[model samples]
Target: MSTLIGKTALVTGASRGIGRAIAARLAAEGALVAVHYGSNKAAADETVAAIQAAGGRAFAVGADFGTEGDIDALLTGLDAGLGGTGLDILVNNAALAGGTDLENSTPDYFDRMFAVNVKAPFFLIQRLLPNMRDGGRVINVSSGVTRIALPETVYAMTKGAVETMSRNLANSYATGKRGITVNTVAPGPVDTGHPMFQIPEVVEGTAKATALDRMGEPEDIAAAVAFLASDDARWITGNTVDATGGMFLGPRF
Candidate 1:
């Protein structure tokens, strides 16, 4: 499965969870990886170490993803890490969950969520597009809440924007035989070490929501991203490949 043998990848929010798993998966498939982190230096280093231990090439990079100049700094660092070479893969997976709801939503929360989950990645791709080699791959980590309308109004709206961007970018690059491909991978009720699952109501509710009678693991989503990044998946783009383990399917109970 060395489909990415000659590729270079930048995976943001790669310090832990799905981001960490995707970073390792790409490295394992033989891509030179730049693992991006936000304030989790140790976790980023650990990702690098684990990849290296498995005989994969990877490095750790850091940037604040929600602020001005932060994304440029991240791109600059990634380029330097690759020795000014072209990029072949990008996983825009870093995200912040604004606990803001209907009544408590603040101007600051809306601003921050849109900035990180929508504006930043959208522009970062634009800045890096010139450097991305033809036939490149871009996987945006999205959520199923957009379809289910789970009350994460602000967060889900931003990811919805990502979904639309991916489809448009895929069409934009459709002319080239080996041009870039962009797609969103949406997961539902993933267990990313958040303590919310410990709450009895949350646990029961999520379990009932999913036909699998459980939640998704981070690796499940990462595995899907790895596949989409491969040449075998070159024909798959401009689509939302749901990875929710039947969570979004079945008759309403």
Candidate 2:
């Protein structure tokens, strides 16, 4: 974990769930973390306090990622937080989830989904890359839904786009002198306090869906992102690391 000492990381949606876990993990590794949140200042503050309590450095930044001028606002906050330091890790973990099937999906809903899940990360990276130091890392948080059939067609499509972007960006940005690493971590059936998990049946079904016979925790996904963000993963790029607990490994039979 000391490998990240003196490095700096930015994690979007770090107010809760997997993003929160990732921020904590990175901070534990000795990186100064900038925790980004959409509209939850209290949650974001809590995250920062927790990191500091654990002998780590962290700060919270707020910006509604799907709205107009979102990238500008995020950069404004991040610049203030970072001072003159360059970014060493960028985690695109914020996204809009939960969309209906094609028949029920609306144009507005679809656009919003893309705005946060796809467009936001795309432009955010475009703006952040200038500040990212050589040998930095870009980690996109995708979903297992992209590899399996799901009712949330719009949401799945958005993740698919992120996976593609991860590959393409790794190729385009990770040049000889740059050495940047870009990758995606796709998690499956994570227990993130979503309302849908309140139902006992849904919980049971999700647990059984994985070959491990247990739903994933936010730390599970965070561990994967931590690896990709570290110097140990210098050779690994343009890849999707499946953090799905063997979900969709094949029929149960």
Candidate 3:
């Protein structure tokens, strides 16, 4: 649990759901975590408070993706919170999820989706690389929808781009002198305390979709991120770890 002692990590969109879980897990491993939120300081504060309560170090940072100067705002807060320390881990988990299909996928929707999902992470990595410590870790959160057929076509496309970017950067940016490791974690149907999970039918269907025969939890994905951020995954890079519980792994027939 102390694998991350003296490390500093910034987890974007960590106000709730999988992001929040990742923030907590990293803190528990002895890292000073920055819980990032788009528009919810209270939720981010809650995450930080929980980490502090558990005897871990954490703070809240706010910056809305897809807006003007989002990355600048995020970096400013990060720089202040870290107090001149270099970052050891970066988890790009913030995203705009759901509701973009072929019919409703207008130009505005497409731009916004790419802005938050694709553009934000890319620039974040590029801008943070200088301030990031050598041998650091960069873990990007993707989705199982990239592989499976889903109504959120635009959303899936963004994730596919993420996978490709991760692989490219893993080889070009993180290798050799840098020694940093870049990887992606794609989660399946996760129950992130959403109201939809309250429906029995939704839960049952999602459970049946996976080989594990259960809906995934936020903690499940968090565990995967924690593993990638640790020294244990040093040899592993430019890969997408499917933390999907075997979803869409062929028919049960």
- For each candidate, the alpha-carbon lDDT, in order, equals 0.87, 0.92, 0.94
Candidate 3 lDDT (Cα, 0 to 1): 0.94
Clashes of each: 2, 0, 0
For candidate 3, write residues 56-106 as lDDT tens digits: 999998999999999999999999999999999999999999676899889
TM-score head-to-head 2 vs 3, winner = 3
Clashing residue pairs in candidate 1 are: 135-178, 135-179
Q: Which residue segments of model 2 deviate by more than 4 Å?
A: 173-176
Best by lDDT: 3
Which scores greater on TM-score, model 1 or model 3? Answer: 3
All-Cα superposition RMSD per candidate? 1.9, 1.3, 1.0
Taking the tens digit of each residue's C-alpha lDDT, what string does model 1 give over 13-69?
999988999999999999999999989999999999999999999999899988768
Using alpha carbons, what is the TM-score of model 1? Answer: 0.93
Q: lDDT tens digits, residues 1-253, model 2?
A: 5769999999999999999999999999999999999999999999999999999999999999888889999999988899989999999999987759989999999989999999999998888887689999999999999898889999999999999999999888333259888999999888899888878999888878889888899999999999999888999999999999998788998
